[model samples]
Target: MEKQRNVLQVNGLNVAVKSAQGMLPLVQNLQFELKPGKILGLVGESGSGKTITSMALLQLLNQKTMNVEGSIQLHGRELNGLKEKEMRGIRGKDIGFIMQNPMNAFTPVYTIGNQFVETIRIHTKLSKKQAIDLAIASLEKMNLQEPSKIMKMYPFQLSGGMLQRVMIAISMCLRPSVVIADEPTTALDVTTQLQVLRELDRLRTECGTAILLISHDLGVISELADEVAVMQKGRIVEKADVYRLFDHPQHDYTKKLLQARPVLSVNEELSKLVI
Candidate 1:
């Protein structure tokens, strides 16, 4: 089979924050590729630099306080040194972002419809009516009910899962080439998490959008990612195809992580085994 085209590439990526002591490296020499219609799962424990790496790729870090070095290419275009104005054009249009907290992503004061319309108009030449129509259509795609009514509600008025689904809809509305999802299923019930994951999987199939899924859960990675990269202490310790990584992890850290997964049966049958 022919190799798929790469939508995003990161090489020698590093992030360092200025501190009283000196520059502290948060992410070191990170590298990865996201291909069209493929998901790259970045998995690691908290403070392992996964989120920082994603932010660096998006050029969302503050340049003054945080020093980010290396190449971040989207469709072969360099994103490292682009001005804020130039980056703005690429953000929602070329690459969409689903933040960890859906509430943090929206303005509590604005109605969902109003925010969607503004986002759509900013990226495209759509009029208010056109944008509203598009927004409602996108919501429908997520299996959301009463799209028109939901649009009229403020972000605060909606449930967490509802807000998250709406956020996913907004991220995908423009059909961006890449979507950076940062712990998208965090703080959700298992059923809701599955729903969100399904929506993400659908985006990959329907829009052929590459995904950079950041999470600490190996199960989530195994479910959605084609390839996986394991990060620890600011560096990638292991990377491989999903099956290979799970079946035969090369690094000690990876092996430990796999072993750490809670075995429901083992715990439940512990008393029987002891007797």
Candidate 2:
């Protein structure tokens, strides 16, 4: 088999916040690589620094009070010290992000189509009509019905699942090299969750987009991630291929996480756990 190239690499990543006491470390000495067309699952409990890590990669953290140290390389370009303008060009173009809350990703007042066209126009030189066409095409890729109709509806008028799918469509419309999906399926029903997961998998297969998927659900990780990193207390204790991580987890926290879920038969596929 051919080796896949690394689209994103993080080395010696540490995130700290200033408080009255002193600097409080949220993520410590994190290191990982995201390969093209593969999903890397970052699994951890709440407050384990999964979200902060992703934010740091995008340089989305506030520089005023937060201290981020180490290297974040996208396509071998260092991004830690880039200016906000430079980072803006990288974001949505080279690196797309899907936030945990779909509603928070968009302006409540704007129609979904308007936002989509604006986003595409910002990243590309496409005209308004061309951008709208692309947006509708991308939404159709998510299996969303009446893509044109979805564009006219305001965020509040759409269901949570619909909004989540639209968020994915927007993030992917640019066909970014790396996509940071932070809990993309959180708060959604089982069917919606499955649809979202399938869309993510399709992105990997169809577009060869590397995905850094952060989720608390082991089942979700098992279904989508090629490799899994088990994090606890802001540190990754174990890292392995998805099958190895599930069948032979090395860390106690990983073991406990598996035990916390319902029992599965030895012969069952990891995807079966989702249903």
The best candidate in terms of TM-score: 1
Alpha-carbon deviation at 31 in model 2, angstroms: 0.5
The TM-score between candidate 1 and the true structure equals 0.96
| Alpha-carbon RMSD, each predicted model | 2.2, 3.9
Supply candidate 2's per-residue lDDT for 212.
96
Which residue runs does candidate 1 get wrong by more than 4 Å?
266-275
Residues 1-275 of candidate 2: C-alpha lDDT, one tens digit per residue: 97766899999999999999999999999999999999999998898899999999999999999999999999899999899999999999999999999999999989999999999998999999999999999999999999999999999999999999999999999999999999999999999999999999999899999999999998899999999998898888999999999999889999999989887576567667766
Pairs clashing within candidate 1: none
TM-scores of all models?
A: 0.96, 0.94
Please report, as a residue range, the 10-residue window in candidate 1 with the lowest summed lDDT.
266-275
Per-model CA lDDT versus the true structure: 0.94, 0.94
Candidate 2 collision pairs: none
Error of model 1, residue 33, in angstroms? 0.3
lDDT of 2 at 173: 91
Going through the candidates in the order shown, the clash numbers are: 0, 0
